[model samples]
Target: MSDPATNPPPAEGEERTSDASSTDETVAVVQAQEDEPNFTPITKDFGFLPIPKHLRHDPKHPAYFGLLLNATFGFAGTFVLANLYYCQPLLIQFSHTFNVSYDTVSRIPTLVQVGYAVGLLLISTLGDLVRRRPLIIMLVFICASLSIGLSFTTNFAVFQALCFLIGVFTVVPQILLPLAADLAPPERRATALSIVLSGLLLGILLARVLAGVIAQFVSWRVVYYLAFSVQYVVCVWLYLVLPDYPAKNKGATYFGLLWGMAKFAVTEPQLVQAVLISIPSAACYTNFWVTLTFLLGGPPYNYSTLVIGLFGLVGMVGVGLAPPLGRLIDSLVPWFASVIACVAYILTHVIMVGADGINVAAVVIVCIGIDVFRQMVQVSLTTAVFSLDPAARSRMNAIILISLFIGQIMGTAVGSEVYTQHGWRPAAALNLAWSGLMLFVVLARGPHVSRYTWVGWEGGLEVRKSKVTAQKRRDEEAGASDIQQRGDEKHALEAKQSVREEKDLQDATTVGMQEVKISETSEGEKQGEDQPPMVEVATLSAE
Candidate 1:
C-alpha cells in the first residue's frame, strides 16, 4: 500500500476529495503538540498514591494553586529550611561528642550559615535558568544524602564538612519562594508568601524543639537520621505534587545570572535597602537565638537541650504573627511596616538588656517579641524587594538571602564569642546597637526621607502626602516621555508612508496620460482610413 501523504495525482475523471479531511487531521496534530507542556518530567507517574486532579500537572487547564499546594509549599519549606537550625540547640551535644571546646563546635552552625549563603549565591539563582521542580528535587535528594552522612560521621572534620554540604544543598526553600510568587494570584500573593514564610519560621523554631527532644531521649545522631528520613519524604511529596515551572530566563547562563544579582544589588534601591535592613535584623535575630542556647544552658537557668528547645515553641507565638503581618504589609506601605517592626525590634533588645540572664519571664517576653518583630521585618522587606522585579525574583531573593545568612554567620561566630568572653549583657548590648542601626537606616531611607529631620518623627501626614505627590509627578513625567518617544516614531513612519503613496499616485497619473495619448493616435488612424480627419482630441483623467 502507498502512503496517503505521497498519493499519486487523481485521474482525469476523479475528484480530489481527501484534501479537506487530511488538512483537518494535520491541524489536530499541530494543536495537540502545541497544547503539550514543554518540560521534562522526573517521573512518568505520580508515585505511591492517587493524586487529585487539581494536584496533577495539566498544561491544557492549569489548576489554581489553592490551599493544598500552599500547605505543601509551607510544609516543604519548613522541613527543608529546618536543616539549617537543627544544630543550634544541639551545640552542647556536638561539643561533648567531638571532644572540642564550645568555641570550636560553635563554628559548625556558623559554617552551615556561610555555606547556605554560598548556596544562595550559587544554586538558588538557577531557579531562573532551569525548570524548578527538578532542581528542587535534586537539591533535596542531595541534602538527604548529606544528612545521612552527618548522622554516621564520628570525625569532627567530617561532621563539619557534611554539615556545610547539607547547608549548601538545602536551598530548596529559596527556590520555592519564587515559584510560589509566580503561581499565586496577585491579590492573594502576600497570603501565599506568608504561608510559606510561616512554614520556614516554624521550621527554624520547631527544628530546635524536635532536635532537642530527640537528642535528649536518643543519640544526637538519631536527629540526623530522622532529618534524613523527613527530607526524603518531603522530597517525594514535592516530586508528586509540585507543578513544573519553566525557567523564567531560559537561555541565561549561570554566570550571567550571578552577575545579574550583583547588578541588581547595585541598581535596585529597594532591594539594596531591604538587604541592608535584613542583614542587621538577621544578625540581631541570630545573636539572640545562638546565644540564648548558651545563656539558658549555663548558670542560672541550667536548661537541658530539651528545655532549651522548648523555647522555640515560645517563638511559635511570633510565627503566628506572620499571616497578619503579611496582610498588614499588603495594606500598608512595606517600608512603613518595616519602620514599625524596627521599633519593636529595638524595644525587644532593650528588654533583652534588662533580662540579665536571671529574669526568665523577661527572656520569654524577649523571645516572643524578637520572633514577632523579626517576622514583621522579614515579610515587609521581602515584599518590598519582590515588588521591584517579577522577572528577577530568584536573583533578587538570592541577594537578600545571601546577606541574611551572612548576618547569621556573623551572629553565630560573633554572638557566641561575645557571650563566651564578655557575658550576656554585652552580647545583648551589641544586639541593641545593631537594632539602633536598623532603626536609623529605616528612618533615613524609609517613607519621607526628604522631609524627615530625625528618625521619621519630624515628618507627619503632610510629609507623606508631599512624598506621594512628588512620586506621582515623577511617574507621570516618565510615562509622558515614553509615550512621546513612541508617538514620534509612529509619526515618522506615517510621514514616510504618505510620501511613498503620493509618489505612486504621481507615477500612475503619468502612465494613464501616456495610455490615453496612444489610444487617441490609434483612433485618429482609424478615422483617417474612413475619411479626412481634421484634429483628434482626447480628455484624460486619473483615479
Candidate 2:
C-alpha cells in the first residue's frame, strides 16, 4: 500500500485515509495523555465522580469479613434452630423422661416448625421495616429464654408451647443469610452465602450429634441449658458487631409493605420461577436428613443416638466443597452447572434408597453427595433471585424463604409417613422421586433473564434501562398524547373567554348609541317649538 497519509493518492484511498486519520489521531492523543501525570479530555466536557476515602473496601481480607458474620450471626441463629432438633436424637428419651407417648413428643418438633414458619414471616417482615441488627439481638435473647424455659419444664403442654416459640425466633438465620450476601463483594457473594448456609446445615447435623453425646453422658435437659448459654453469649456479641443497613421497607405500612413485595413478585417472573423451582428441591433435601436418623436407629444395624449423630460428621465434606463449587459457578454457564448439580442430588437419592444393613461406606458417600448438591443449588438459586432485584433483595428473600418453610413441613410429613409405612428404602425412594421431578423442571424451563437486568454486583449497584423494544415506542406515544391533550384544553379555555369579551363590548356599544339618539331628538324638538311660537307671536302683532 502506498503511504496515503501524505497525499490523497486515489479516490478510494482518500475515503480510507479520512476514516483512518481520526482513529490514528485519537490513539496519538491517548498515548500522549499517558505520558502526562493527569490529562483532561478537552473534547466534550465530562468529569469523573469523586471517590470518597471512607467508602473504599479492603480486598485482602474478604473471607475474614464473611467469617466474622458467620461466627456472630450464623453461630447463634443456627444454635436456636439446632436446639429445636436437639430433641430429635433425644425424642425417645424426652418422651420417657416426661412419661409421654412417642406421638405426643413428636408434636414438639412440629410446634417448632410452626413457630419457625411464623417467625420467618413476622420477624423478617419487621426486619424489613426496622433495623435488622436490633431485632436479631432481641430474637436471640427471646429464643434463649424459651430454650431455658424448655430445660426446666416438667409439663408437656408448656414445653411444646415454648418449643413453638423458639421456632418463631429461629429466623435469625434468614436475616443472617441476606446480610452475608449484602456484605460480600461480587466474586465472594456466593462463597459467603455458602459458608453461612453451611453453618445452617452444620447446626442441623451437629445439633443431633451434640445432643446425642450430651444426653448419653449428662442429661437431655443439660443440652438445652448448654444451647441457651451459647445463644445468650452470641446474642451479646452480635449486638456489638453485626452491621446495620437502612431499612428496605421504610415508610411502608404493615400491609402495604407486604403488598409491595407481592406486587414486585407478580411483575417479575424470574422471582416466581426461582421460588417455584426451590420448593421441591428443598423438600427432598430436608426429608433425607430427618428420615436418615430414624432408619439407622431402627434397623438391623440398630445404632445408638451417638452413632447416628456421628453420621452428621460426614456432612463436613459437603461444607468443605462449597468454596470450590462457588468458584466454578463463576466459571461455568449458570443453568448448565445448576442442572449438573441437580443430577448429583438426584443420583444421591438412588444411592440412599439402595442402602441397607450397617452400610457405613454407602451411607457416608450418599450423605456427602446430597450435601454438596444442596449447597451448590442453594448458592445458584440465591444468585438468580438477588440478581433480579438488588434493591428489593430482602423481600425477594422473604418470598422465596416462605416456600422453603412450606417445603420443610411437607418434607417432615413425608419422611415421617414413609418411614412408618414403607421402611427406609421406600422413604428414600420417595425423596429421589422429588429430586427427579425438580431436575426435569429445571431442564425443561431453562434459566430466564428478566425485563430488567442488574449490573455491578461487586459494588452492589443497579442501573435500570429499558430492555424491551416496544418500551421506547410506548414512551413516545405517551409523550405525544400528553402534548395533544394540553393543547386542546388551552384552546377550549381561550374560546370561552373570547365569547364573554364579545358579549360585554356589544352591551356597552348599545348603551352609547341610545344616549346619543336621545340627545339629538331633544335638540331638534326645541328648535321646532321655538320657531312656531315666534311665528305665532309675529302674526298676532301684525293683526
Candidate 3:
C-alpha cells in the first residue's frame, strides 16, 4: 500500500507513467514521489504487534475459531445470494433447458441483485439493533432452506422468487463481519476483518466457478442442493458455535436506533464520503464479473461455464498476494496506507478498461491486478469504518454495506443495459469512470483516518494519561518527583494497613461489649434500684 511512485519499479521495459498532457499539479505530485528516496513501509515502525501466543492458539480468539465460523458462514452467504450469478455464463444452457429466452434468464441475476438490495436495507439494518448471533443463525437457516427448495422446483418463476428470498437472508454474513471486527483485538482488527472478507471475496468469485463445474457435470439443480447441504451444516454450526454479541445501543428502541444510525451517517462528512466513493468502486467490481461472463460465453472462444469458472482461480492468486501488500501498507508511513489503496484501485480499473481484446494471459494478469487492488481498497475501507466508531462499528459497517448494495444494483443494471446496447467496452468504461471518481474522493479527502477524533470513555482515559504524564514531568523539573513517589507508595501501604487494623479492632471491641451486656442481663442488674417495685408489679398482675 505504499504510494504508487514509492512502489518498487518493474524491470526495465515496463510502462512507467506517461504524463505529457496531464496537469502540472498531478504530474508534480507523481514526480515528487519518484524523486524522493525509495521509502517503503519497511522503514516505518507503526505497525501492530504480531499475534500473541495465547491468542494464536485460543479457540475463543476470533482469528482462530472465529475465522472458520466466519468462513463457513461466508460459504453459506455466498451459497444463498451467489447462486443469482449462476445463469450469467450458463444462460444459454438455462435457456435451452427451460425453453426460455436468454434475456429472460438474465432477469434471474437482476432480481437477485434487487433482493440483495432489500436485504441490505432491511435485514442488515435490523442486524445491528438486535443480538447478532441468533439473527444471523436464523437468516442462514432460512436462506438454506430456500436454496434447498430451489433445487426441487422446475418452474423458473419459482426459481427467481427463491433467489430473491435467498438474497433476503444472505445479509447474515454481512452482519457477522462487524461481529468479527468487534471480536478482534484492536491491534489485529484489520487482519482478522480481512480474513473474513477473504471468505466473502472467494464466495463471490468461486460461486461462479463452482456453479460452472457443477452445471457441466450435473444439472444446475445439483448446484443448489450442494449449497443447501453446506449451508444447513454451516447454519447449525453458526447457531451452536458462534457467540452472541450484545447490542451496543442498549438504551435505544429499535426504531430509535435505526433513526440514529441514519441521522449520524448522513451528518458525518467522512461517512458521507465513504458512501459516495464506494458507490462507484463497488459498481466497477460488480460490473466486471457480471459482464465478463456474458462476453466470454458469446464470443469466438465460446468457453463453457466450467472454463469461465476456472478463470476465477486466477483471482485466488490475487487474494494470496493481498495480505502481503496490506502488511507492506501497514508498515509504511503514517496515514499513507489508505491513500495507496485508493490510488491502486484507480490505476487498476484504468488497466482493466484497456484490457479488452488483449491476449488471455494479459487479461488474466490484469484481472489479478484488479482483484488485488479491489481487495486492498476494501481492507482499507473496513479499517477506516471501524475506526470511526468502535462502539457503533456494526451500524457504520451496515451503512457501507448498504452503499455497496446500492452500488451492486447500479453496476448490474448498467452492465446489463450497456452490454445489451453497446458492448463490454462500454461497461468497462463505466467501471473506469467510477474508479476515477473514487480516486478524486481519495485525493480531495486525504485519508478517512484524518477526520476521526477519539471520543467517549476511552477519550477520558487518554486525557487522564496525558495529564498524568505532564504532571510527572513538571514534578521532576520542580525537584519533587522522588518525594512524591515516596509519599504515594507510603500512603498506599498505610491505607491498606489502616483498613485491616480497623476491621480487627472493630471485631474485638464488639465482642467485649457483647460479653458485658450478656453478664448484666444474666444477673438481672437492670432492676437493682427497684427490686421491691418489680415484685409488687408482678403480684398486682397476678391478682
Candidate 4:
C-alpha cells in the first residue's frame, strides 16, 4: 500500500488554490520544526517578570538542577537576612560613641525587630501580590542604600529609624523560603525547606558574633558600611540567578493580602496550631540565649561579651542537624517529631536548672541538645504550614516569621527582666514551664489518622496503596462474574444434550417394536400355510 504521508503533492498553480497552498506550506514548516530531534523550547519567563512554573511533579521523578539551585538561593538568604542582626552587637559600640545610656541603646535592636514585625505584615505580603524575584531585588537594594545612610547618620533618632528601615527591608529570607518550598519536588520539599532554614539559622547565629568581632578590630561604623557592601553584592547576585516566581494572589489588593492573613489565623486551625508551637519554641530559644549571655557574663565563669557571642557556636550543631531531621519528618509524622522536640526542650531546661546551679560543661551540652531539637521542630512545622496553603505559601510564611520574631522579642524582654530581678535558676524554671506548654500544644495539634492514614507511612504511599487495593477489588468482582457466566453456559449445554438423548431412545424403541410384529406374522403364516382363511384370520386379528 502507498503511504499517504509520503505521496507527491498535486499541482499548485490553480487559480483558486493560492490560499490553501500557503496554509499547507505553513503547516509543513511547523511540522518540520516539531520533528527536528534536538529542539527543546524554553518555557520559563525570566526576561520580563517571574511567572513561576508550577510544573506538575511526581515523587519518583526528581530534578537535580532545581534542587541545587534551590540550595544556592537558600545560601543567598543567609546574607540577605544577616542585615537585620548586624546591629545587635554594635549596640554597645553605639552607646559608647553616642554617649547614650544602656537602656537608650537597647532600643536599636528592639526597633529593628519591631520594624521586622511591621515588615512581615506589609512587605512580605508583596511576595503574594507581586513577582518575588524582582520584589526581592528591589527590597535588598533599598536595604543596602539605607545601611549606607545609617553609617553616616550621627543623630541618634535618625540612626534608630534607619535600623527600623533595615529591619523592614531585610525580609528577603522570608520571601526566598516559600519559593524554595514551591520549587522543590514533592518528596524533597521538606529537605529543601530545612536547608533554607539552616541558612536563616546560620545568619542568626553568626550575625552578632561577626559584628562584635568586626567592631573589635575596626570602628563600629565600618560594620554598617560592610553591611551596605554585602547587600549590594547580594542584590546583583539575586538579579543574575533568581528567576521570577509569580504572585499567588495576583489580583489581591494590599489590604486584601493583609486581610487574608488575618482570616487564615482566625479560621485556619493549622495556622493556630503552628503559632502555638512557634511561640513556645521561639520564646525558649531566645530566652535561653539572652539569659545565658547574662549568666555567663556575670557568674562564676565571668565570660567577656565576645565570649558570650562565641557561645553561639554550640548551636552550630543545629546547622548540621536541620536537614536530616527534616528528612525524618518525611518518614515519621511531623507531630511526633514536634512532640519529641518539646520534650527535649523540657528535659534540657530541667537539666540546666540544676547544672547552671553547678558548673559550665553540663549547661553547654544541654544548650547544644536543645538547639538541635528546636531547629528540627522549626523545620517540621514550617514544612507543614507550607503545605497548608500551597497557593498562599508566602503569606503563610509571613505568619510564621511574624509569630517567631514576636516571640523572640517578647522572650528577650521578659527574660532580661527576670534575669536582672531573680537569677538564672528562676529563668530556667520559667523556660521549663514554657516547654511543658509546647508539649501540650503538640499533643493538641496532632493529626487525626483515618484507616487509610496509617501512622509512620508516607502520604503518597498510602494513597497509592488505596488505589491499588480498589483496583484489585474491581478485578476480583469481574473475575467472579466471568466464572458465574461460564457456569450458566455449562448448565444450559447439559440440559440440551439430555433432551436429544431421550428422543433418540424413544425412536429406537419404536423401531424395535415394528420388527417384532413383522417376525411374529411370518411365523403365523408358516403355521397356517394350508388354511385358506389365513388372510381373513390375520385381518380379524389386526382389527
Model 4 vs. true fold: TM:
0.72
For candidate 2, the C-alpha RMSD (Å) to the true structure equals 16.3
Model 1 spans with C-alpha error above 4 angstroms? 1-63, 89-107, 153-157, 294-306, 355-358, 413-423, 446-543
lDDT of 3 by residue, 126-175 (tens): 65566565577668778778887778887878877887887766777678
Please provide, for model 2 over 210-249, each residue's C-alpha lDDT reduced to its tens digit, 9 standing for 90 to 100. Answer: 8888888887999998988998988767655665443444
Can you write out model 4's per-residue Cα lDDT over 391-426, one digit (the tens) per residue? 677788899887887778778888888878999888
Better candidate by TM-score, 3 or 4: 4
User: Which run of 10 residues does model 2 get worst, by summed lDDT?
Assistant: 455-464
Clashing pairs in 3: 41-331, 41-332
Candidate 3 versus truth, CA RMSD in Å, comes to 18.5
Error of 2 at 431 (Å): 2.7
What lDDT score belongs to each candidate, Candidate 1 first? 0.77, 0.68, 0.64, 0.72
lDDT of predicted model 1: 0.77
CA error at residue 272 for candidate 1, angstroms: 1.1
Off by over 4 Å in 4: 1-67, 449-543
TM-score of 3: 0.66
After superposition, the stretches of candidate 3 with alpha carbons farther than 4 Å from their true spots are: 1-100, 293-306, 325-335, 353-355, 413-430, 448-543
| Alpha-carbon deviation at 74 in model 3, angstroms | 4.9
Residue 176's lDDT in candidate 1: 89
